[model samples]
Target: MELGACPKSMRYGPCGGVRTGGGCEVVDEPCPFVGRPLVEWAGTELAPRAIELPRFLVDHRPTGDDRVDRQVLDDYAASGVAVLLGDHLDDPPAVDRVAAAERTVDAGVPTIATITGRDRSTDERAEMIDGLLAAGVAAVLCVTGDHPSARFTAHPDVTFVSEGTLLAGEVRSRGGRVAVAESPAAEPTRQRAARLVEKQRAGADIAVLNHSGPVADVIAFAEQASALGCRLPMYAPVPVMTDLASMAALEQFPGLTIADDAVNAMHTSSDPFSTGLDLAVAMAGELLGSGSIAGVNLSGVATSGGAVERGRVMRRVVDAVTA
Candidate 1:
């Protein structure tokens, strides 16, 4: 009777798991929904979705172009993982793509390049697209890079020149898998729903929901995605601020809610490593159970070590839940 639980009609295999669909059969139970197949609201048949978990990448800037940063990227690629680069780096969007591509050349891990709207010129965008194709970066997360407002000049510097959805479409047309970032509470629920529909319509292959709020909010958001008739993948963010300075910096991000207790707990905890593992397990369980989510996107922090650790945690969680 509970959502995500096994249906009655499905037969169980010898594996001791419920076989709701054709994927595999569980051993010890009768199918709950005997005659009723799990179908999308529009009456479409459902399919098992595989998840892609990549390492989160950060851009490190040192005055001008730095070889050190490139070396750091080499280390990241060695893990056969992807990363997100900061937008502040020179050339912003395209530079990250180029850097990531360079690493992919040697490491063989796919790169999920970030695109910031401001630093990208028409020419740069063209070159970046060419570079991505050449490097074969798996997918691109299109976002309007974060911009500062009114620090000095009367006119503050601007951020993303175009909307993320439109930009994603452009990338997709050019033979790239495009993912766009959206916030559940960037506005009211209705507004978010409308925007999500529009993004799907515009050719976004995946939607990344930054850190989730209440469970109800996430369910509602997933329902909206289903209604939009677009089965694009959804990436959920799980924040990682295991220390005081990091926690403080995270709190400053707009729309982020890091509980004071949670922050302090992470700071003093001796077993933060285990804590992260536990959190990843819980999140992976929920994500896999949903049947709607295609993959898990680890957001918030960016580093080779951080991404590899989280990716390992995710892999463990997936094996547990799916098995």
Candidate 2:
């Protein structure tokens, strides 16, 4: 497969390159950072994250089965996109949907399932993860979730659940990839640094940042993670929802102040949907250009024609960065 203008050496393949026919070929070169401004970032003391597109393709699908909308799943596969299944626990329906969607999409790319503390008991969450693994859901993202219980009624003060270390151990024991969430805006830089360390210690395979801030802040957080010996890939989730839903998610949630800042920081139309997508795309451009961000995840956004439009935007960012 010709990688267009991208250099063969920088081209990544699946499985982070292997010694298949040659000694070591990049099976999946997430993105290019070498010769980029990454070196100047914090004096080169940070982990360069892979260029990933972790998208929410089928959120709260109908039919209560594990099956996602076939068209939705297919679009993800066709576009080289990965789906992060929704946040439903306790209801076997939600858990089953992950597997069904994976099978339905058959995209052959990596897929992740989200595990939230509010959704299931600790044991139940573990079982749900196990089911995801059995169904080929190797990657898992652990979050505090939106509510105290699966009912979405309560809002706890602190929601950073999954005890990063324990969850990573669980996934690793099962030989699966595990990811955790991070927010530069969640706490003081020092505290965020400590939490990142804790997550790394928990055997997290990657870190998915919740909020997007200045390039300096982004680089600082990435640097801090590296200082702690966390080479795990890092990602940023860009919300692409209708303006109203995006605004609601931002305004309603106590921790969504960052999203509000993101909205305020941008100079776009007042319309939420257009504003969200435009801002998401712009932030994505910055992330890709940073050379420190590994990849991006698309969330809080609705799909268009069964496809995650952000993936296409990401491709443009990747091309620009690599070029």
Candidate 3:
């Protein structure tokens, strides 16, 4: 391959996205900086991995924010959160998710509401879409809601809902940007690849990987999807590793991955918060650089401060990488 162009910031600065495995995050190639006698390679060797900053989103937990809406919105907005995501957390009458998204839009930030394809009747599902449209929600992620058994076994938030593909088709016909979730891919299989293609054929604009796992999983899924003829824009989910308890919770959630190394690092590090932050930066940089991925969604239960700080740092990394 020809030498890719580099930015001034990276031309002479330390490369933070250099993986612990010693691979260049900007390119899938070996770290050119490693064992190189040429000093300029430190700055100019790896061309900027991205031509533009990918879409960065903050996944906000569901809140009865009549209590803290203003503070939450202001905090996220100030923290440089570019997009807001309100999950269809376990709550009665999944339609409530649309209202949750409405609250996000009311905050003046673009938001995405996750709608489940179960629980409600067909009319209810359509009404939910109408509610989001009327509320001016910028986007919606239609998901095949959790199974009924999950409510009792998992966090109280799991619930079955409508079909995600049908929801995406409806949202598209109504002119709302729509997304769907994919999962369980440290290793990709044909079944998973075919499902992704089916979802895209159903009108999903973006394929949001369902787990908070390693960047490799996302890349692997993308490659498999491409091989299967699924052209959906792929968006990887990044975890907000604050408390170990919350981080560990991801393991129980189906379709998400929290690698053992990550788990161990967060558990053993003197400052787990910074350690997790570095991991997020590295993963986001890798995903952004990998041309297969369209963007990333930062997901976790974090304070508005934590969420904002995550976005700020990731944005800086993007700025530097694409500088």
- Structural similarity to truth (TM-score) of each candidate: 0.63, 0.64, 0.70
State the lDDT of candidate 1 residue by residue for 208-233, as single tens digits: 66554544456567778678565667
lDDT of 2 by residue, 144-175 (tens): 44333322454343333343344556666666
TM-score rank order: 3, 2, 1
Q: Of the candidates shown, which would achieve the greatest lDDT relative to the real structure?
A: 3
**Full ranking by lDDT:** 3, 2, 1
lDDT of each: 0.49, 0.50, 0.58
In model 1, which regions exceed 4 Å deviation? 1-96, 150-156, 214-216, 258-273, 302-323
Q: Supply the TM-score for candidate 2.
A: 0.64
Expressed as tens digits, the lDDT of each residue in 152-213 for candidate 3 is 34433322334565666777777677777766342223345566666666666666776635
- Looking at model 3, the pairs that clash are 11-43, 90-157, 116-162, 117-161, 117-162, 117-163, 118-161, 118-162, 211-256
TM-score of 1: 0.63
lDDT at 94, model 1: 32
* Highest-TM-score candidate: 3
TM-score of 3: 0.70
